[model samples]
Target: MKKILSITLMMLAFAAGTSAQQLEKLFEKYMEDERFNYVYQKKPGMVERLNDAGSPDLWVFEKSNASLGRRMLTLNGGEKSLEESFTREVETALKADKYEQVSIVRNGKNRVETYEKITDQGIAKVNFIKNPGNIMVTLNLYAQKK
Candidate 1:
């Protein structure tokens, strides 16, 4: 019985890790879907620098350190079935990843939520925005500023 419990625990831990990585897989899976729009940045520094130089007040990433990279996936004007399915998948991944919900803002038909997960290197932030006909998920990775 003890051995069985130990194996079960290990399996659960492995599943959690895999689910966390599913978020990235989710992005890759839908990136080329005609129903979605995708944007990826290898180095988000240029945009961060521009934001810092232009509007210091709006540059909040500094609080996390420096921007290492960013990826955004947008689902726009899709069928109700597809939208529902995508939403479910995103929610499942977030829950499995154990990301802490940092903030949520609701304005009329639009809702924006932020989640953060701490890593050894730094922090990973996700911004999820949903409107009546649109859903956007943005993942931002930050590294410790040297």
Candidate 2:
């Protein structure tokens, strides 16, 4: 009886640990995908175009090594407010049909926000805004590999 009880407890502990790890992994994947999509859609090519036009603008997001980490990219430009431009660009990309159940939020201290398409893999959260001399963008993506 004692051996059986000990074995049962050990199995339960292992199961609990596995579940916790899985949850953490899921959160990390979600954040990574969210950030990657935001950068891929917004920065890279667009910044060069803005620069060539003699615009004081460039943007990039630096991601963390870990999943579910805080990632931020900033855009630099001389405009009084890049808010409208940022919104339009994001809206256009989202409308292009890459993601579903998309949502956008404005008027928050953080500025523009949107949800990436939910996939069988996971979820993604993206935020963008014009702050001081730069436009700041952030992404939180969650994906789980089957």
Candidate 3:
């Protein structure tokens, strides 16, 4: 009986690990680009910075809710609001009939929020986790360009 119990426990652990791995794989397929240099999460804000090699003055920062699933894209030195950029991107993409299958959801129990951008660029996804203290956050960035 003890041996059987031990075997069951081992199987359960393996299954959990496999699930986590699958989640990570899915997330990877949804990130923006590989050129992003800095990704940091602070209180109430999560920032992802990317540099445009062709135009040094053009810097993009994706800022989103550290807790909720709301997100916005901003030009670092530009006068435009991040929210406006976010809206414009969505509108343009929709008008061009680019992204039609994208979806987003928040899992309260796991404290994880996922965003899946399904387009010709492939699926770009992000996962955010809130730690026990509710003060620290872990963000998994995944984007497939082309």
TM-score of each: 0.83, 0.36, 0.26
Model 3 C-alpha lDDT per residue in residues 53-105, reported as the tens digit of each score:
23343222232211222232222333335334433443443334322333334
* Residue-level error in angstroms, candidate 2, position 38: 11
Q: List model 2 lDDT by residue over 5-107, tens digit each.
A: 9999999888765653332243244345432222333232434334433523311121211123334445555355454554455555444424443445555
Off by more than 4 A, model 2: 1-71, 80-86, 97-110, 130-133
Model number with the top TM-score: 1
Off by over 4 Å in 3: 27-139, 142-146
Candidate 2: lDDT over CA atoms? 0.46
Off by over 4 Å in 1: 1-6, 52-60
Index of the highest-lDDT prediction = 1
